[model samples]
Target: MKESHKDIWLKRKQLGRSRYLVLFGLLPWGLGLTVITSLIELISFQQINPVWVPARLVLFFFIGFFVANARWQAMENRFESDSQQRP
Candidate 1:
């Protein structure tokens, strides 16, 4: 049996969502959060704490990851609705 158009469109939309999550959300957020937190300590104290820095970095990275996921979900919902409305 052949696949349907709706199925294909849905698959594409899912892929877009995943890509957005990884590229637009998770990666930059993780990198930015880490850098920002690290810089905060560095600038405030003029020196980085070896232990606390890595911990803070990981925490910030996860925070960014969740924010990205939320953004991607909203985009995905919009795309699905838009596709459904078209002929």
Candidate 2:
């Protein structure tokens, strides 16, 4: 069964959970990027750079946060543009 966008948005808006969900939703993307970058470095150098892994994670964490926030804002706009609830 396919869930409608309104239902998904309602879930996100409920209990103000969207605040955290929006940001955390980017976790998989950030982690995948981090792992890919780290692996590239590992393959090139033939050794793991301990410092870079944590550094990339921290950097991407912040970056992902901002990106997620922007995405959440965009989502709000998208919903507002066409599917706003009636008062």
Candidate 3:
């Protein structure tokens, strides 16, 4: 535990600051993915289990959401840094 590990404090980890999450931009993307994927699944449901259908919908949406969000976050940070560097 960090509390007990006195040595840990001596050699403090040089971890980078955590990401600054901007929910305003990311929320729409996440919800959009959820809605779009769910609509696609609406076309058919013969193969997938009824219970798993919602689960799959949720999974696909979240995967798309997180992946897109991460990429978007990186791009946002890059653009910000680029803008700051411009004279």
Off by over 4 Å in 1: 1-19
**Candidate 1, 69: how far from true, in Å?**
1.2
Put down candidate 2 lDDT per residue, 1-87, tens digits, no spaces: 124876776677663645654445447556867898988988999988888888888787777777767766776787776554444
Q: What is the lDDT of residue 63 in candidate 3?
A: 65
Candidate 2 lDDT score relative to the true structure: 0.69
TM-score per candidate, chains pooled: 0.66, 0.68, 0.43
In candidate 3, which residue ranges exceed 4 Å CA deviation? 1-46
lDDT, residue 22, model 1? 67
Model 3 TM-score is 0.43
Cα-based RMSD of candidate 2: 3.7
Better of 2 and 3 by lDDT: 2
Model 1 has an lDDT value of: 0.69
Q: How does residue 44 of candidate 2 score in lDDT?
A: 95
Clashes of each: 0, 0, 0
Better of 1 and 3 by TM-score: 1
lDDT (Cα, tens digit) per residue for candidate 3, span 1-87: 233342442232222112212232234545665565566666575243467556655676566557655755665565566557777
